[model samples]
Target: MEKKKLITDDGIRYDGRKLDELRPIKFQIGTLKNADGSAYVEWGRTKILVGVFGPRESHPKHLALADRCYIRARYHMAPFSVEERKSPAPSRREIELSKVMREALEPAIFAEFFPRTTIDIFAEVLQADGSTRCAAISAASLALTDAGVPMRDLVSSMAVAKVEGKLVLDVIDQEDKQGDSDMPMAIMPSKNVITLIQMDGLLTHEEFIQSVELAKKGCMEVYAKQKEALEEHFKKTMDREEV
Candidate 1:
């Protein structure tokens, strides 16, 4: 089968976005009543739900750290999340992404504040589009904040890809699968600290720098959306209590 063209002659992506444009992003906080905190995010066609549990005692006893909270993250996809059903059991990609998600959020968290405890972040992909890990990271960050975890700043993420010999931001599934380079990145926007950067394909030195800048721009926008969601949720919560 032939691959569809990702970019058009007029510099528009197949999804009708400019090279540096991002997909429409939507976020909601406090989506789960049972969890300590939760958030849901919809980025383009991707959907994710994240639940953050505990600065509580570590289970199994031995997993507890001496000076800081152990951060555990699980990134999972529903069997029906994709067009084709995925295995219910954890896949190697899911395990790797779980580790990656934990690392990305750890840098922003003040784990020592809740010493010997555990903070577990669970990200569930309800639907997979492109850049599912990036979406999950963004939602997990919001979920952590929703759980009242102390953090230096929120982690926002996005992917940049070299498609058809040109760089584009917020790649879709096709672009990611067929592009020359696909880089997913996360940053603590307030600190301007990069928390995660991973590439699946090749890029020249110049392209890497350009992609970083593009990804930064995308993350900043995502950060704004996150802040808006948090503020709105809190405002509504306060209003309900006043009643």
Candidate 2:
């Protein structure tokens, strides 16, 4: 079967977003009472829930850090998250994404403040679309902050890709499957420091640079939403306390 084109000749994407435009995003913090901190995020069709625990003891003794806390992240997709039900077991892709998420977030955390401990991050994908890893990282960062973990800054992430020979921001699943390139990035927006950059498919040097710049812009927008979600949650809590 012939695949449908991802972008129209008039420059509209499959979902009607323009090149460089992002799909609608929404976030909620402290959604799980049992968790030390938790957040839920919806980025386009992707939905992720994250829970943060610790600054507590690390298991197996040997994994304990002498100078800093260990950050352990796990990324899992629910069986029904995709069009086809995926196996519940952890896949290689999930393991790699978990490692990438931990590394991306490590730069922002002040792990030294909690030596001999570990900060555990659990991210579960409730719905699957393109950019699930980036969305999970963004949500996990907010969960960490809500848990009262010290941090240098919040991390925000976004994916940029080349579709129909044009650079685009926040590609969806169809675009990811059919597009020429995909680049996912995470950054400390306050410091303008990039912490993660992973690419799939191909891009020229110029296109690579352009995609990074575009991804940064998208991350800033995501950062704004992250701040708004946290602030909104706090405001509601304060209102409830006063009543």
Candidate 3:
């Protein structure tokens, strides 16, 4: 197969992006009122919403330490998110993805500050074309910030994939299905520290390097959006106070 061939021989990929381009993103913080913090983000066709609850009171059977807050995350897809309706039950895939997302977010958050409490991150996928896991992580990060949770740095995530023997940034749904491999990564941009990384399929060392580079480029874009959203949130709050 020609690998779905969204791009043509003239050097254009599907959606008219260059090999290393990512989708445009729109993000905002404080979308929810009751939650401590919340954010919403949309990357191309992928839409995700995240809500944060507490740094307060760990539930029964605190298997983790009480000296620091526990980080819990849930990843869910709505029935109408995809072309086909999804099952309501929480499947293994969602559980695993949730775990990775939690890890990616924990380091950036000052979880120890809330000792004996729990921080719950809930992510809902309203529409998913590709890179939903990355979207979830990004959204959760923003929601934490919106919730006024202290953190060392902002975390952003992106995905890179191999298509037709070439590396591409921010794979779309169709590309994901047809691509040879996919790698999703979360990073703390200022520190250049990688928080979470996952990959599927195979790649040579050279390909891996190219994919990581492309993913970093995409992540930088995501970070920019994250900052913009936070600034907007604060600006609105300041405006409200003034009024």
What is the clash count for each candidate, in the order shown?
0, 0, 1
Clashing pairs in 3: 129-173
Q: In model 1, what lDDT does residue 43 have?
A: 97
Model 3 score (lDDT): 0.88
- lDDT of candidate 3 over 7-81, digit per residue (tens): 778657888988887788899788888999998888999999899998767786554566788888999998889
The pairs that clash in candidate 2 are none
lDDT of each: 0.94, 0.94, 0.88
Candidate 2 Cα deviation (angstroms), residue 87:
0.4
Query: Residue 86 in candidate 2 has what lDDT?
Result: 98
Error of 1 at 170 (Å): 0.5
Better of 2 and 3 by TM-score: 2
Residue-by-residue lDDT tens digits, candidate 2, 161-202 = 988899999979998998988999999999999999999999
Q: List the residue pairs that clash in candidate 1.
A: none
Off by over 4 Å in 2: 237-243
Q: For residues 1-243, what per-residue lDDT tens digits would candidate 1 score against the true structure?
A: 699998999999988999999899999999999999999999999999999999989997899999999999999999999989999799999999999999999999999999899998999999999999999999999999999998999999999999999999998888988899899999999999999999978899999999999999999999999999988889964655553
Ranking by lDDT: 2, 1, 3
Query: Each prediction's TM-score against the native?
Result: 0.97, 0.96, 0.94
**CA error at residue 50 for candidate 2, angstroms:** 0.2
